[model samples]
Structure formats: C-alpha cells, structure tokens
Target: MLLVLVVLGLAAAAWARTASRGWGLAALGVVVVLAAIVLTVRPRPATRLPETGELEVGGRRVTGLVLPLRRPSGAQALGVAVLAVLFLGAAVVTFVTQRPAPPDAVFGMVLLAVFGVLFAVAALALWAASGRVPYVGLTPTHLLVFQETAQVEVPWSDLAGVAPVVARTGASPLPDAVGSWVAVRVRTGSPAASGVKLRGPASRVVTQVPGPTGTTTAALIGDVHWAVDPVLAWWTLSYYAEHPAERRELSGPAAVERVTAGDLR
Candidate 1:
C-alpha cells in the first residue's frame, strides 16, 4: 500500500512536470483519496515490544508479573528527537545565514538562545524516559507500586475491587494533556490508600478519586497507551482482580501463558 502510494505520488509529480498542471492535480487527488482509504481501512498497529518470555526489562529481571509488560513505542521518542534536531539545526542555520534588520537581530538571537535550551531539555527528558522501567506488584499480602524512594502501598486485603477504566474520568483537565492512558480503578476505602497521583514524571500515570465525592477511590495509570496494548492490559488486570483463585498462578510462568493464550477473555 505504501509502495503504491509512493508510486502514485511520483507519477503525479512527473505528470505535472512533463504534461499539464490540470492532469497532475487530478492525479494527485486520486492519490490522496487512495491514501485516505488505505489509512482508514487498515488496523492500527500495536505497540512494539521487547521479548517478555523471560520478563526482563532494561537488564532487570522480574520474579513475577500480574501481566507482562510491552516496550513503549519509540514514536514519541523519535518525534522529540526530531523536534530537537530541527530546532537546534534551525538556530545554527539562522545564526550562520539569516541576516535581519538591526532591531530584529536581537529578537532573533533570543529566539535562537531559547531554542538551544529547549533542545537540551528535550534530549535529557528523552534519555531519562528511554531508560526507565515501571513495575507494579501484587503479592499474596499486599498490592505494591514500586518506586525509587520512600513510599507506601495498599494491602491486597484492603482492596474492595479492581476495574479497567478506559475513558477520560470526571472533569479533571489532566487527561487532556497526554494522548492515551489506562486508569486502573483500584477501589479501597482504607486510610493507607494513597490519594491522587498524576502523570507528571516517570511514575504511574495516576489520578486519585478520593472518597469525599464518592464511596470509592481510584488510581489512573496513564501514558501506557503508548507502552502496552491498553485493551489487553485492562482485561488481564480485571481478570486477576475479579478471580481470586486465578491469582495463585500470577507469580509464575503460568501467568505469562494465561495472558498469551487469551485466557483472560
């Protein structure tokens, strides 16, 4: 399909150059229609993944898993890299070649200075994200969210229930910030239960649905839309949450097999 589109685009250009502009415009229109149809008709690509047969990520191995993880799609990283390169490149090019009126020169210099800092910050953030790994744990006794510093966790006994939250919840403006996120609804009224946690840094993209407005609480896991198969992860989490007996296999290879075999459905 891509090849066909490329050929059509080339043909349109050639026709415009060698023949008539009207014919080229018509050909280009046909190519556009075909491209739209192809894009719409095809299934969306799933996120790319590293091999999880061993449940290893970033050279770190896991003893168990509720569900295996997926390598985040590099599209976001690539995009950031591209933007950084373009901004930095533009600044250099402007410095070397662009000559403006006297007053505008200072304005241009400031813009160029800002561009350098932006590129540096973007590259640093990208590097940090690429090397990070997030792991969630549900032991026989507790539900743990592994973090780099001093923190607390919810006990399994404290869990009222777990459900997959796929949509933008409530009137919170936070969800509109990122593309896709999985808000895992972890319901509990215990005091140990942590409150709202947003998708600010490398932590779980979470939003707290405290008991004040409602009888239950929630923890939203965002940014995984680019990480894992959101639907599959949703189902698998729900399956383990709802089926207590099934969780016995969660700490072993059988859990991996269950997830792989579509047993969650």
Candidate 2:
C-alpha cells in the first residue's frame, strides 16, 4: 500500500516536469488521499477462520482463531508489477531526456528520487510479509495475533472492553456495502496495550491493545462483509473478554462448530 502511494507520487513528479505546477500539486494531493485509504481501508480477510481444533500452549488448551492469509490477489500483484515496470521505464526516460536540471525542477527531482527509493522498500516489505502465514491464537492466557509487523499477545485480564463497529464506504440500502468490525480496549500500562519494544515491522496497523471508545472500543477488524459473520466474531471475542472461566469450553471442536453455526445466522 505504501509502495503504491510512492509510485503514484513519482509518476506525478514526472508529470510535473512537463506539466503545469498546478497539475503536479493535484497529482500529489491524490497520492495523499490514496495513502489515507491504505491506512483506513482495512482489507477483508482472504480466508476463513482456522480449522476447529485445540492445541496445548503453556500446559493449557489454546484455540487457534484463523487469520486471513496475507497473499496478494492476482489483480493486485499484476497491478503492482505493472506499476513497477512503469516506474522503471519512467526513470529511463528521464535519464535519456536529461538536460541541465532546471533550478525550479531540482526540488521535484530530489523528491521523486526519494519517493522512488521509499516505494521500492515498501514493495519489498509487502512481498516479504505476503510469504509469512499470519494468524491469531486464542488461549486462556492471552489472545495472540501474529501479523506482518508484530506478534501481539493480550491477556484476558488486561481486557477493558469489546464491541462491534460498523463502517461504510457509502450509505445504501444494500447490506453488502456496510463493513462490520470488532473493537477491543485494554487497560493502560499493560504490556500488550503499549506493546513490547521490538524492532522490525509487526502488524501495528491497529492498536493491538485497546483504547478509549466512549462506551465502545478501539477500531480493530474491519472492511468485513456480511458473509464473514461480524456478529459471531464480536460475540466470540466479547464472550472471552467478559467471561474468562467459560473460555476453556471453546477449546473443543464441537463448541467451535456451534459458535460458527450461530455466526452464519
């Protein structure tokens, strides 16, 4: 996503070289909006929950909550590839057409160069993250989410609240246009809330720990469709947050089946 924005910025810079300054600025503005979308438009989970099963973690049963696989769609991959090629082609064109750098265009050229490097780095990161199998595990001790940026573990005791959030791209009578999500909040000063100090990229897109939501919670899972059963996702997480003792019951396949079945409704 970051790479996409950078590519657009570079393209805009190239356009600015030959076009009006106003046109260049307009292109940059669009790039900004696209960057915002990358942050706001949470992608739908590509896969359903993990298989209904149990696993032993720290001598206790832990249930694996399936996270959507992070692979890019064919269209997405092809689009990025094409964009990369175009960026390269543009670079060559710029080189071949090189004349004395106009003083006015010097800043633009530097900006383009910087953005090009950033775009490459972001593209590489996205590629590498795609290869890892990301997932979240629910256990009596903690809720573990392994993502591109980080592995987050939130203990049930630290949980503050859980609620459902509905976000929409546009208002319509159609249900498919609405996005359902689960928001979670945790007590301040907890390790999971603040996160352990780590180095490399870990899923830091949303707060792994919760925040204030004025009778609600932090916006978590989102861009969900009706088919994904947001209610079930909300119910399961909320139940665990509110009723820790009964959480162990969900460690069995039968229980998972019942919960999933209910979610379909």
Candidate 3:
C-alpha cells in the first residue's frame, strides 16, 4: 500500500508538470519493479574461505579447488513471506467487508491463502539454514564437496580428468550470459567410477565433453555450478591432476593463498 501510494504520488506530481515527465516516471518505475522481479538474489559467492584458509567440513577436506553452489538468500524469502501475509490480509478484509462482493471473491481468497502458506514455509526453511551454508574443500587424496547434511569425496585416483564447460544455459535473455560447470570426467569402464553419480544430488546437465570432432565416452557425473569462479575451480582441479606432488598443499593455507591469487606455479 505504501509503495502504491508513493508511485501514485510521483505520477500525479509529474503529470502536473508535464505529461511526458509523468509517462517517463511511470516507465522508470515499471523497469525498477521488473528488474527486482527478474533477479532472485544478489550476485555473490555462496561460500567463502576464511582468511586462515584452512578449514574442515563434513569430515572431508580439499585444497585449492572451489566448486560452485547455488547461492541462497534467506532475506529474499523472508521479504516475500512478509508481503504474502500483507496482501493476503488485505484480500480477506476486502472480501469480507465489501457489500455485494463479486461471485468469485471466495475462490480468489482461497487461492491467495494457499500461496501465503507456501511463502511462510519458504521463509521458515531459509531462516533455519542461515548459518550452515555448504562448502567445498580441496584435498590431495580427493575432491571433497560438502552439502548441508552430507558430503561427497571423489578420490583423485578414481577420476580421469576435470574440465571447465560453458553450456548454453538459456537462463537469461542476454546472449553472452552463459553458465559455467566443472565436469569431472570419469574413466570409461572403470569400476571405481560406478558410484560417481552418488556424489551429490542430481545434475541438470549430463552431456559429455566436446572434443575435436565429437563427444567422448567419459561420463559427466552429477556436478554443481555457479561457483564463485568456475574457471579457477577448473584450473586448480586440473593442475593437481597433472601434478600429483602438489596435492598435499590442498589442506594447507598456502594453497588457499595461491588459488586466491590466481598464481601459476
């Protein structure tokens, strides 16, 4: 109601000055509202390593590498919950107090109430998971990914290779806005790779890596995306795969410093 009043006042004030000015104000207002609706959360990393750089999670560990995770924002959910409650209350009040209410008023009220309940549930869940955001670690022996409740540790010996893949997400209207992924290519017919799919939840894309002319038989298992920087994740993983001697540093602060600096050694 307050936002509506503010916009209405701005439009009215602008119109008194000039019709063109009023229309421009209304257009700007529409664009602001649309941008807010389009973006789900602030574009930031979902996880961050502390200054010390050495940390342990999920009884597993990793060094240097960082995989992407879906950034979660509880504030966004809570804001929606508050609005849902307000709008729902207004709808109920209007339906009950209005004389000669429309025939569909009750049905509309019911639908709105159901939506309100969903918003409330989302708000509660987000708040509950506030401080426990999952993190990924780099270790010499394995590629460790920690989730909210469980973790996945893929031994370096069991993996064939890792590469950075940029797939056409079509997630945005902008042409250049592509999504990044770290594809852990599993060795074909390797018995150890059989359980790779159980590493995490399910991946949205499972296509093979593109080579010179066609795709390879190496399986792309369940992988995460949207890490703070996918290219860095790929570089760290690949570097360690090629240089087995440096794997031990993954559990130390020096590795974190190097990864953060984008240093090539």
- Give the top-scoring candidate (lDDT): 2
Q: Write the per-residue lDDT of candidate 3 for residues 12-61, one digit (tens) a residue.
A: 33322232344564455454434434443455555443232344534533
Q: Which stretches of model 3 miss by more than 4 angstroms? A: 1-71, 98-103, 168-177, 185-202, 207-228
Against the true structure, candidate 1 reaches a TM-score of 0.54
Worst 10 residues of 1 by lDDT: 49-58
Winner by TM-score:
2
Off by over 4 Å in 1: 1-62, 66-79, 92-101, 135-138, 144-153, 166-181, 185-192, 200-219, 222-228
lDDT (tens digit, per residue) of candidate 1 on 146-233: 3322223555555665554334443454454333443433444565455634444323223333323332433444444234565666
Shift in Å, residue 101, candidate 3: 6.5
Q: After superposition, how far is residue 153 of candidate 1 from its true place, in Å?
A: 4.7
- Clashing residue pairs, backbone N/CA/C < 3 A, model 2: 50-66, 149-201, 149-202, 149-203, 150-202, 150-203, 185-210
